[model samples]
Target: MRILNLLKIAFKAIVLNKMRTLLTMLGIIIGVASVIAMLAIGEGSKASIRETISAMGSNMVTVRPGADDRGPARGSGGDVQTLIYKDYEKIKEEVSLINYITPVVNGGGQVINGSNNWPSTIYGVNPDYLNIKVVGLQSGSMFTDAEVQSASKVVLLGQTVVDNVFPDEEPVGKMIRFNNIPFKVIGVLEEKGENTFGQDQDDVVIAPYTTVQKRILAIDYLNQIMASAVSEDDASEVVEQVTEILRSQHKLLDSEDDDFTVRSMEELISTFSSTSEMLTILLVAVASISLLIGGIGIMNIMYVSVKERTKEIGLRMAVGGKGSDILMQFLIEAILISITGGLLGVLLGLTATVFIENFLHWPTSVALYSIIVSFAVCAITGIFFGWYPAKKAAALDPITALRYE
Candidate 1:
C-alpha cells in the first residue's frame, strides 16, 4: 500500500496500453504548444511596436488638426485644416519644454530625375524636422533657414527615393522634379526601411514648409505639427501644454471643444500594447479548447480503465488491499501522464517559436511564466479529471465485484 508501489503498479498498467495512453496525451501536447507559441507572437509584436515608436522618438508629440470628438457641431477629422503658420510661430516662441518643433505638410506625386521616376511624398518642414524625428543625414546637409524663409526649392531625399530616382549616381546635388516643380537636392536622409504600420519611411523628400505650402499644394493651413519633448518623462506635460496653447490660439471657450488633437508616443505605445495583449488572450482562449478536450479525454479513459480493472480491484481488496491505495494509484497514474505530456509540450513550443521567428520571419518572445503556467495547469487538470473515476473505484463493493462474470 506504499505510494511508491502504487506508482509502479499504475505505471505498469499504463505501459501495458501504451498506444491508448499516448493517444490520450495528444490533446494536452497540442494545447500547451499552441498557448506558448501564441503568447510569444503577441509579446513579440508588442515589443516590436514599442521599438518602432521609440525609433521615431520616444518623446515625440504630434499635433494634428481636428478634435477627436467629431460631429456636425465639432471639428471633423483628417481634412480639418485649422493649424496655421501663426500657431506654429507662437508655439516656437512660447513653449520651453520642447527640444525641437516643426510644421508638417505633404503632397504625393511622381518624382522624376532624367529618365527615371518613382512615386513619393514630399514633406514640407523646417530644419528641426529631422531633430524632432530623431533622424540623421547620410550625405550633404539639411536645407538652411534661409532656404525655408525664401521658399527656396531645396530638398532632401530618403534612401528609397534615391535608389529609384537617382539609381546610377549620387543623389546629393542632383536636380529632381516633384509634380513638375524642380527642386535642388541638398541632402539624402539615412535609410529607415519601414515602420510598424508598413509605411515606407524612406520614400520621402523633405523640403521647407514654405516651399511645399506655396509650390505644391498651394495651401495656407498647416497639415500637422510635430515636436520632441526635452525627455520621455516630459512628454505628457508637453502634450498638455501644447493642447492648452492650441485651444487658446483657436480661441475656443470652455464649452466649445478645440479643433486639434495632441498625442504622445508613450500613449501610442500603451494603446498598442493593450491591443496586442487582448489579441493574445483571444488566441490563448482558442488554444485552451484543446486542453479542455484533453481533460475530458482523461476522464473518459479513466472511466473505461476503472470498468476494465474491476475484477483486479476486487482481487486486490480480497487480499486486504485498502481502497485508499487503489485511489492513490489511479490518481498518480493520471498526473504522471499529464506532466509527461506537459514536458514534451514545453520542448515542442520552444522549437515552434524558434522556427516561426527564424524561418517565417515572425516575432516571438517566450516568457518563462508561460511554461510554468502550462505545467501547473496540466497537473491541476489531471487531479480535476481523474477524481471521479478514482473515487468510484474506491467505493466498489468487493463482494459483488468478485461475484461478477
Candidate 2:
C-alpha cells in the first residue's frame, strides 16, 4: 500500500473509535502541559531574582567591621567598631579601580513634618553614595560635599518615606525633623520596589554620614562602607585592593585576622543564580517523570488496540495487504494522536502560564526551547510506545487472526 493510503486508513481507524482515541491522547496532553508549565515558572523566577538584584546596584561592594575582643570577651562578627571614617577616605584616595566610596552610619527614627509622622531608617552617607547605589532623584538634588563637611541637616527621602510624610505636599526644601533634629529635605529618591530578599528599597531617608555620627548616633566609628568598582570585570581586583588597604589601616600583622569583611554584588548574584538554576533543574526532572508515565500509557493502549483489531488486520492481509503496510498504519496512527495532543498541550500550557501570572501574580516565562523539547518528547514517545504493538500486529498469522472471535 502507498504511504498516503496507510495514513488514510490509520486516521479512519482512530476516528471510528473517537472516544478511545481521545482518552489515549489525554496522557500525552497532560505530560507535555506539565513540562512546559514547570519550566516556565522556574525560568521566570530566575529572571525575576536577577532583575531585583541588578536594580539594587551595579558592580557594588560593601565593607563592614568584623569581630573584636573587649578585655577577653569576644564580640560577634559585624558588631565590631573597627571600620572607621579613615578607612573610607583611604579606599577613595588609594584604590584606582574603585569608582565611588562612602562611609555609612545607620540609624532609625520618627520623621515628622507637622501633623504627618512616619518611622523610617536614616542612612548616613556621602554624596558618592547616590551614584554607588545607583539611586536617582525623583525631585531636587543630592547634598554637596560642603554640606557633608559641615554636617548640615539636609536629607534625601525615599519614595515610601515621601508618600507617608509628604503625602499632601511637595517634599523638597521642606523641613522634616529626625529624632527631634530639624533636617531640610534635599531630594526624593526614585521608586525602587523591593530587593531579592523582600525588603522595601524605598522606605527610608538618606543624610550626611557626619551628621548621623556626630548629631544622631553620636559615634566615631562607621557602621559600614559602600563602594562601587569601575567596572564589573574589575570588581574582584577592587575587592582585593580594598581588603589590603583596610588591613594596613587597621595595623593588622600578617598572622592577625582582619578586622573587616568585604562583599561584592557580583558574588551575591552568582550565588543566587546558581541556587535558582539548581531549583529549575530539579523541577524539570520532576516534571519529566510524567512524560515517562504518559509513554507507558500509550504503550498499553496500543497493545489493546492491536488485540481488538485482529479481525480487521486479518481481512486486510487476506486482501493483499503486506505486513509492512499494517505496521506503517498502526505507527502512523500513534504518531498522529501524539502530534495532535502535543499541539493542544502547547496551547494549554501557554494559557496556564498566563493565568498563573494574572491570578497568582507569579512570574512565568515560556521559552522556545521548552516548546521544542516538549514536542520532540511527544514524537519520541509515540515511536517508542507504538513500535512494539505494531510489530506484534504485523507478525500475526492471517489464518489464526481470521479464526479469532
Candidate 3:
C-alpha cells in the first residue's frame, strides 16, 4: 500500500473514536507539559542566581573573622571580632590583584526623618565600597576620601531606605538620624531588587566605616572586609594573597588555624550552580514519570484497539493488504496521536510558564532545547509503545477472524 493510503486509513480510524484517541493522548500531553514547566523553572532560577551574584560583582571576595572553637562548642563567625581596620589597610597595600578594598561594619537602628521613621540596616564602609560592589548612584555623589578620613557623619541611602524615609522629598543633602545621631544623606544608590537569598539589596544605608565603627557601633574591630579583584581570573589569586596576609598579621603558626576566613565569588557561584543543576535534574526526573505513564497508556489503548479491529485486520489481509501494511497503519495512528498531543503540550507548557512567572512572581525560562527534547520523547514513545500492538494486529489470521461473531 502507498504511504498516503496507509496514513489516510490510520487517520480515519482515529477520527472514528475521537474521544478514545483524546483519552489515549492525555498522558503524553500531561507528561510533556510537566517536563517543560519544571525545566523552565529550574533554568530560570539558575539564571536569576547568576545575575544576582554577578550584579554583586563576580570578582569580589569577602573576608570575615573565623569561628572560635571552644572544646566542641564553636562560636559563629560573627561572634569573633578578630578582623581589625589595620587588617584592611594591610590587604589594600599588599595585594596587587585587589583593585578595591573596604572594611565593613554593620548595625541596625530605627532611622527617623521627621514624621516618617523606618527600621533599617546601617553599613559602615570606606569610599571604595560602592565601586567594589559595582553599585551606582541614582543622584548626587559618593563621599570623598577626605570625608571618610575625617570620619564625617555623611551617608548614602539605598532606594528602599529613600522610599521609606523621604517618600515625598529629595533625599540628597537631607538629614536622617540613626539612633538619634544625625547624618547627612550624600547620595542615593540605584535600585537593585533582591539577592538570591531573597534579601533586599536596597534596604540599607552606607557610611564611612570609621564613622560607623567609632560613632555608632563604638568599636575598633572591623565586622568584615569586602574586596574586588582586578579581573575574574585574578579572584582566586587575590583570595590566596588575602589569606596569607591575614594569617601572618594574626601571628598564626603553621600548626594553628587562621583567625580569619576568605571567600571568593567564584566559589559561591560554583556552589549555587551545582545545587541548581541538581535540582533541575531531579525535577526533570520526576516529570519524566508522567511521560512513562503516558507511554504505558498508549500501549494499553493500542492493545484494546487491536482486539476491537481484529475482523477489520483479517479483511484487510484477505483483500491483498500486506501484514506490514496493517502494522504501519496502526503504528501511524499511534504516532499521529502522540505528535498531536506533543504539539498541544508545548503550547500548554508555555502558557503554564507564563502564568507562573506573572502570577507567582517567580522566574521561568523555556529553552529551545527543552521543546525539541519533549517532541523527540513524544515521537519515541509512540513508536516504542505502539510496536507490540501493531505486531499483534498484523499477526491475526483471516480464516479464524472470519469465523468470529
Give me the candidate number with maximum lDDT: 3
Per-residue lDDT of candidate 2, residues 108-155 (tens digit): 899999999999999999999988888899999999999999999999
Question: lDDT score of model 3?
Answer: 0.91
lDDT per residue (tens digit) for residues 330-403 in model 1: 89878877887788888888999999999999888999998999878888888989889998888889997676
Candidate 2 Cα misplacement greater than 4 A, ranges = 1-5, 45-60, 68-81, 84-101, 107-121, 131-134, 144-153, 159-167, 176-183, 191-203, 208-221, 228-245, 248-251, 264-286, 314-323, 397-405
Ranking by lDDT: 3, 2, 1
Clashing pairs in 1: none
Q: Which window of ten consecutive residues has the lowest lDDT sum in model 1?
A: 70-79
Give model 3's clash tally. 0
Could you tally the backbone clashes for each prediction? Answer: 0, 0, 0
Model 1 residue 218 CA deviation (Å) reads: 11
**Model 2 residue 3 lDDT score:** 95
Single out the weakest 10-residue window by summed lDDT for candidate 3.
67-76
Q: Determine the C-alpha RMSD for candidate 3 after optimal superposition of all C-alphas.
A: 5.1
What is the TM-score ranking, best to worst?
2, 3, 1
Q: How close is candidate 3 to the true structure, as a TM-score?
A: 0.72
Model 3, position 265: C-alpha lDDT score: 92
Candidate 2 residue pairs that clash: none
What local lDDT score does residue 201 receive in model 1, on the 0 to 100 scale? 92
